[model samples]
Target: MKKLQRIFIYTFLSLAAIVSIFPFLWMLVSITNKSVDVTQGRLLPGTHLIENMKTLFATVDIVPALINSAIIAIITTILTLLLASLAGYGFEIHRSRGKDIVFTILLLSMMIPFAAIMVPLYRMFGSISDTAPFIGIDSLGAVILPTATTAFFIFFFRQNTKMFPKDLVEAGRIDGLSEIGVFFRIYMPTMKTTYAAAAIISFMNSWNNYLWPLVILQSPEKRTIPLLISNLGSSYSPDYGVIMSAIVIATLPTALVFFLMQKHFVAGMMGSVKG
Candidate 1:
């Protein structure tokens, strides 16, 4: 009976894993096949991989879109780590009246759906387009600004900060370090795993962000990877192979980022829970 139960568990886990991974497997296979072959549900790999890639690169503005995505994701990740860590450190370290109340409000704000404020955010950016073209609508700054830091990130950092040793801050202060110096030299280094986790999440969010960027950016050159992929499917006669190729390429960066920092991400999340 125990052997039968063990077999059942393993079989169930195997099925679940296959279900989760099938779409990605299909996508990779589709990229190597022609549009007709892909549409016909070919499960086997084909010889059209090079042809599809050549067409995708030769015809699409994938390179520019990739560059735009990289710029926004990188900048947003950096700003999020900086601002969220600072806020988290302060909330955890500084004792002040109504601090919990303020933090509560911030967390509640996350419950408000982005769709609810999309119009207002668009109008706000539109209102400033003429005065600040650099950060206005249709610009990369617009894409990065709204998502530079989120309530979830703040909450995440704050939770993780709870586990941090307060003695270090005191030690740094005793050593005559300023608040800024202590944060930069002591806090940042000690929280490397948390930062790594935050970075992975932030970068992935910014890279895959479509709605705000779609609404804000109108120019072709300003388009990011998601927007570019949307365009690939917009045509009346969409090429499945090319679309899959683009998707595979678009997926590579986030995949690479996650795998590279996977260890740190798990550790940081565990730290957050322990805190």
Candidate 2:
């Protein structure tokens, strides 16, 4: 009976693994095949890999779109890490009345769907376009600013911050470090794992964000990877091979970020749970 149970568990896990990986495998195979071949659901790799890549590059401004996405993702990640960490550290380290209430309100904001605020956000950006064109509509700043630091990130950091030792903050303060110095030199270094996890989440979110960028950006040159991919599929006769290639390219950065920081991310999440 035990042997049979073990066999069943292994079989279940094997099936789950296959199901999870099949789409990525199929996408990889699709990139090598022609559009008709892809539509026909061919599972084997084809000889059209270079042809598909060449066609994708020759036809689209993928490079600029990549640059735009990288810029937005990197900047948003940095801002998120800095701001969320600061807020989290303050919330956890400094004692104050009404702090919990404020934090509660911020967390509650997370429950409100972005769709509810989309119209107002659009109108606000539109109103400021003439005064702050750099951050207004049609700019990458417009995309980054709205998503730079979300409540979820703040809560993530705050939860993780609870596990941090308060004695270290006191030690730094006693050692003649200013508040800013304590944070920059002590808190930041001690919380490397949390930062790594937050960076991965923030970068991925910014890189893949579509709706805000799609609505705000007007110029073709301002398109991010998601927007560009949408356009790739919007054509009357879409090239599935090229689209698959584009998707593969688009997925690489976030995948790389996650894989690189995977260990730290797990540790940070575990710390949050322990806290």
Candidate 3:
């Protein structure tokens, strides 16, 4: 009976995995085919991959857009993780009524739709442009600054931090480590899976962030991959092949990140459950 159950589970999982990966496979196949062939639902590889790539580059400044995305995502991820972890540690370790109230408020803020706050956020950033402006309008900073720290990530880290061993922290302090030192040396190192998990999630969020960036970055040159793909789609005569190629390119990094961090991500979540 157990063997039969195992067989059924394995079969179901294999099917589910194929179902999940089908769209990615389709996208890759479509990238190689020409517009007409793709429109006709051609599933086979074509010789037009190079042509599509060339046309994509010709139509848009893809290299710069890719660079822009990488910079924004990387910088935002680093800052988000650093700030969120610190905030989480603070909330978890230093128990105070005020901090509890603040954390609750922060979580509540996440429930409010981003669209509701977008106008105020736009005006605030725009005001910066109108006033002391270097890293304002249509800049990478505009995109990264608004969402450098996410409430969800803060909450995630805080929950994980609750599972962190307090004894290790005490030991570090006993060895003459300052509060900051203990966190940097002891806690940070011990929470490897949590950090890895958070890193991938935050990086992907920043990488694929569309709405706020679409509003903030108003220039062709400043566009990221998502924006670039959207613009391509809106053109009078869209090229499916090139668009597919662009999509595949845009998607690779996030997929790569997730694959690398899958083990750590699962371990981290399990650890969180233990707390």
TM for every model, in the order presented, reads: 0.94, 0.93, 0.89
The residue-by-residue lDDT of candidate 2 on 1-275, one tens digit each, is 99999999999999999999999999999999999999998999999999999998999899999999999999999999999899988887885768988988998888989989999999999999999999998988888888987888878888888778999999999999999999999999998878888887777788999999989999999999999999988889888999999999999987786688788666655644555
The candidate, 2 or 3, that scores higher on TM-score is 2
Please tell me which predicted candidate would have the highest lDDT against the true structure. 1
lDDT of 3 by residue, 144-186 (tens): 9878887877888899988899999899999999999999999
Cα lDDT computed for each candidate against the true fold: 0.91, 0.89, 0.87
- In model 2, where do residues sit more than 4 Å from their true spots? 1-4, 267-274
**For model 2, what is the error of residue 52's alpha carbon versus the real structure, in angstroms, after optimal superposition?**
1.1
TM-score order of candidates, top first: 1, 2, 3
Report how far residue 18 has shifted in candidate 2, in Å: 1.9
Q: Rank the candidates by lDDT, best first.
A: 1, 2, 3
TM-score of candidate 2 against the unseen true structure:
0.93
Clashing pairs in 1: none
Question: What would the C-alpha RMSD of candidate 3 be, to one decimal place?
Answer: 2.9
After aligning candidate 2 to the native by TM-score, how far in Å is the CA of 225 from where it should be? Answer: 0.5
Report the Cα lDDT for residue 110, model 3: 77
